[model samples]
Target chain A: MSATLEKGVNAFREVMDAPIASFFNSCVHCGLCADACLFHTETGDPKYTPIYKLEPLKKIWKQEYTLLGKLASMVGLSQPVTDAELEEWSPLVYDSCTLCGRCTVMCPVGNDITYMVRKMREGMAASGHAPAGVIEATRKTIEQGSPMGILPKTFLAQVRDQSEETGIEIPVDQAGADYLVIMSSMEIMGYPEFLGSLARIFKQAGVSWTVSSEAFEATNSGIQIGVSDIARQIVMRIVDAAEKLGVKYVISPECGHAYTALRWDGPNLIGRPYKFGVVHVLELLDQLHKAGRLKTEGKTDEPLTLHDPCQIVRRGGVVAEPRNLLNMVASDFREMEDCGSYNWCCGGGGGVSANHRAEELRFKSFQVKKRQIEGTGVGLMVTACANCRNVLEEGLEHYHMDTKMIGITELVAEYLKEDKPA
Target chain B: MSHMDLLIWARGTGLQLALGVFVAGMVLRFFEIYSLGRKPDLSTPRPGKAWAGWKTIVSRSFPHPSMAKRTYPTVVLGYIFHIGFFVALLFFAPHIRLFRETAGFGWPALPTPLVDAMALAAIIGLLMTLGYRLYHPVKRFLSNFDDYLAWTLTLLPLLTGYMAFHHLLLPYTLMLAVHILSVELLLVFLPFTKLVHVGTIFVSRWYNGDMLGHKGARL
Candidate 1:
């Protein structure tokens, strides 16, 4: 083989040899993942097909990773792809994909395209091929500990500012709180209403929850940036805080990927089952609703729709709670056509919203959401995910679609006692 | 032509064509695999995801009463098509004869009429599956050329193969090659495309079963 061919061959091996690369070895390419994918629907491009998305992974598995894959890969059963050839895969893998885990929901083979997308991004990034914004954000995350490069002291200062503005105490290293609630950094930087609604709900629920300014942010950009150990490092903030604080349960906020990390994969990342209970906001709301603790008020009588965040609704099996909570609140609640676990992605997930180059494609790629929401004329859209909230609110904003965005907590919070402008 | 000569020739033609396609097509698949580019993912652990293949089929997939609660009920419907399709594949008599001579294997075939009925049932399943892909919004969104191609890949082999075997639509011998070709195409496609689910579904169901059961959640 020529040097370039050798480089191409080496690239194939580097990808094909890893265990994560071997994970595709487990996928039998059943199209059960089709319904969960967005690009397959949005562009009608077969190459953007979810199962087809795994084709590169599959070939790697068949070629160099598995006993069978290695045999197949070595004997020219599979082709060696050049860096340029693989570069063409960047948009299909990054911009066009949300890694929302919708496809992971229905995979009869349980192949997680989200994880696969993350892995592929890692490879792309290693080759210096990631999207520009992602590369910048990743550098900031690695060097500055947050993607925004907000100093930890600055983060602490933001908490102080929030407490001043809202008169709600966001705690740090409080010794004996019963709950160590973790939230995404976006709550501090952008969407403090999530924090406000959460504080309101937590207050009503009568739980002793504290947010650690030291290790408070729950949304680990590293998780989406294709750095698992770094992702694990970022997620360790909450667990470490919970252990130190002796909090009873760690409440993960309404951010989808954050919830996925804190609630589902938290224990695994921590290298043991969690000592503290991890409760998703939806689950918390569900419990409150079941207990009749949540008194929902001001459910608009106009047509309303519920968008299930991929984390809570699909992978987390939290289909009914928020809707049930919404129905309990909103008098005229209506459902988007394919709501619940079978829903399409909101075109912004797995860090796609942060990838500036992919932003334009994000709205166009949200064809599934658009079609589902088009005929409904829903004035209000409710969801449990903060990122879903941010993305869809922005999606509607970009499209100039007439829809208002609110979280389940927004409704649940309304039923709570407001300490008037103290 | 003597019955044995006709049998040998028919058998030889089918067997040789199948082996050649299976071999040559398999090599092609491997070439594609080697040429394809992918990336490393060593950070995450691959779960052992153990399950007894036979047992999980009954609990998780076949009588998947709870799977209806899943996002894709077509998957349950899929199991029916797969089971019935395989029953026809393994038990059809003419297929038994061809494999016995060429591949050095033989299994008892169902009675001729019973096999014919099973074939019809398989065709009906193919139709039901096709109808679902066409009508359901989620399904419609998920499909591509490959998805439609899969439907045809599933339906055509059963339709033409049945006709070839039963003397229903065309003469038995001529359609047999095409039937065999479709089966061969399926074999090649199976390891390559979404059709690979034939192999992965059982293991995945097992993996899913183990994972869900561990979580005290449903598959």
Candidate 2:
């Protein structure tokens, strides 16, 4: 066994132990998945076909991975896999595909191609087949608790700018607050204004809230890099912090993947659903609108469109909330026909946007987005996810597509009614 | 087209066309897949876990979002083409009754109208999907001659089967000869080309699901 392989064969055995794997024991590929892939779409590469992408795992499963799989493997007819084969598969698996779940969405039978890629990544990561960039990122996240390795004080320093700019008096662990706001590391580094906006929005709405310095970040770069223990450790750190603080609810900042890591999987990974409710900033904003606690005074007339971050809209189902907020602030909103949970990735999700080598793949993947933007005939774009903002800004710069990028919260903050504190 | 004369003519001419399409198509597709082998993506996953990585294939095959998150159409439509297609190839009265002379047991089949409708739908679906393979910019760009050949081979058999069954323009024996020849071609090509995807897709999907679900990645 490779040193990077899971210490025992037990991890492989545990998969069949679950009926989900057994349930998956059945399939006859019609190549329906090819139609749904970003890589296939962007590159017109059939090799990126979702069905073809699964050959490595299939060969192993058929031969040594499962009971029936082994019997099939023994037959001369069984699929085969080799280390050299893995070396070749790395780019197709990592650089070409984004694990964005578009294929999963389009799959006729609900096959999750993204997940398959994730497992392939795990196998690769475990076997030390990970790309140099991914390995480095995973190592950093494992040690630093965030991909960037920004210290807790540095994180606070980033937020301090928000406090100074808005004079919103952002509180940290003010005991007995009704809400605990979870923020992502992206916000800490790039958009401190968002933290100020969250404070301003909440204070105007007459809500009590506190931020956690420990577990301050909601982003799990480990998940992005395909490191499970690193991912779990990140989630557990936040949940432990949430419990220690004893807050009523955890309202996530305007970040897409982080929201999923916390609300959707955090519960299960932490061995239980969180005691407090978990939701995104858009959800909170939506609640404020429904409760008549939020008010907007201005609108941007620039022709604009919305880009739904894949994780937030597609995976987390936080689609309309962002649209509803954007529409409230702007009169001219043209949705890319494929907008909503089905919107294509900005080529930034799944950590691809972060890897230096993946820049070209990122460019190809963003072609769909570029077409969407061009088709919209819009001048400005709004999205809830920071990673989407990073990618769109970077992609536009690279592609020389002239467009403006704005966050939903920052937009909402601009439109907030000027009034006395509620 | 006299009774015996038509049968003999069909056996000779029709079988030749069917075999030519099937064998040539398979050979062309095998080469296409061989070209695709140049792709490094196929070789990315680790080796020697004692089983095939089937996580992604199984999960995506059911409850897809584009299908309105529906399961029935995928299940019913998928099984009919795969299960029914194979059964018809291996067990239809003409194939099975004849095969019994060599190897086999009889199985129930649909009524004439139903079988006719199924064969027709399968042919149309098969061809339409094939045409789509050629037309779709992504599929077209990714396609090799092998891809085209694979589509041709899979569709022709279904088409010939339909024509043979319909027998509006051709005699039954003539059509049946074509159908059987096409089936034999498909059987021979089963391990090569994208046709193999029809088998690989399931295991691939399951592996995908297992990987994502394990990592808490949204599937």
Candidate 3:
């Protein structure tokens, strides 16, 4: 019932489907993934090599699946995956790697190294090798409905504050709404202005939307901790909330993993398609702008660059939506090199920011983003994901840089055209 | 046995045994990979997106422009080694003759000198790659017995083949027998080692592409 090495091995067995089998078999160990990863590039440590991080998984595959490997095991030529080995590898599996998909794109043999890491975390979590911070986050997500342990009452209070500030009555559990807006714990706690921004924009755009009193938490700590059952439970709350409200779409808040959890992984996790469509908040804004439902009066002349979140841009495929929204609001937008889908991670994705033990390494890896920001020579940076914004802020503060960050949705709302609307 | 006898055996029984292991091993390896069927993606794919998997199959072969600076040498050398190896294997006159005899088909062969040049290039590329693997921190950390074994297995045939063609290292009959035997050894081991990537690379690329493509990511 609880964590064990056998259970971990069994989880590994369960996760090893055809693609994984093919990937393990196809790897030539070219080490090109190392160059693609910021952790490896910044640290100059070969242990951070993406494929090397999957050594545990690769060992399991070889021992369990291959003929030569089977023969080797029978003859005592190979060792079984042990608890000590798993403990030793916990940091490599969870701390250093961010599941950014950059290494996945760069693999010469096309091995999806990030996918393997995501799957490998399942085994790590089961075997009691997962980082304590992420596990605690998962526990909080289940017990308090937020990774930050934000209770429903606290979320409602923030909602009330935002509604009062914006002078818009933020709907709560309103059935027959056109959309259901979900917020990650970070957006609710660290950046409540996103709520106000959404309210102002939707009021002007003439859209019908509501926040779920029952399922306001959008981030999935189960995903961060690598437990599918818990992830499915988290997704079902939003699904239930949306279906009960009979909304047409669910808007994922300005969070990277939240969008990935809600839009891409949610259906598969719950084993069914949702009654309502899921859209990133940026995507909805882009759609509203393109359809002429949303209008902007002015563009900011201050030069700024965009930080593309790995999960939302590369993994979730909401690439163009942010660019579309940013162009409408900014006159001096400079793109970082490898902008859009190929942009570097904030070094805090995939629970690295959530895992306190990884703080030093995460800051070290932030050097890549620092160089990227410096390359743009922009004092201001706009990003779509609240988690990325928080991480970027901390990185800038740690490095004592004066670079500033704002969420793209809030930036767009700052330029909203003033007009008469009910 | 005499060099003549060794050459006869390499051209006869050694060829059959190598071919048999190569075929059976590949089938078993493919079965191992494909048998564990994956779950179908249940989520609605991004609508109106082209099949990016097919594009990725061709596109991934070229270094991503953003990654080109960091990866140029490795990718370029990888291409030279693979392309040169294949060119020498399939385009050499003697190789085509052997293919015609075994495969019941033939393609036009490049001139002997051209094939020789390709063989030399392949040898140089592989040597540089081996050096890179030894010198590069990540590659050195990743290398194991299998990587070294695969490398040696691959390089032996090219070295022996070139020597046999030039009659440089040994008597023609002995060198030819050594070349055929080295090629046979490579064939026998191909499906068991990382060299199996020669076939599974396409499958791996397709899966990566398809998963990302389903999300409408331009891989």
Q: Which structure among the candidates has the greatest DockQ?
A: 3
How many clashing pairs does model 2 include?
56
- What tens digits encode model 2's per-residue C-alpha lDDT throughout A259-343? 7677765665556567677767888899998899998888888889998887777766566788889889998989996677567
Please identify which of the two predictions, 2 or 3, would achieve the higher lDDT against the true structure.
Answer: 3
Worst 10 residues of 3 chain A by lDDT: A413-422
Error of 3 at A95 (Å): 0.4
Model number with the top lDDT: 3
Score candidate 2 by lDDT: 0.66
Enumerate the candidates' DockQ scores in order.
0.16, 0.09, 0.82
What is the TM-score of chain A, computed separately for every candidate?
A: 0.85, 0.92, 0.98
| Candidates 1 and 2 compared by TM-score, better number | 1
How badly does each model clash, as a count of residue pairs?
A: 18, 56, 0
Estimate the TM-score of every prediction: 0.74, 0.72, 0.98
The chain B TM-scores of all candidates, as shown, are 0.69, 0.59, 0.96
Tell me each candidate's RMSD, in Å, in order: 7.2, 9.9, 1.3
Ranking by DockQ: 3, 1, 2
Candidate 1 per-residue C-alpha lDDT over A326-393 given as tens digits, one digit per residue, 9 for 90 to 100: 77767878787767766778888877888898887788876667777885677778777777888887
Top model by TM-score, which number? 3
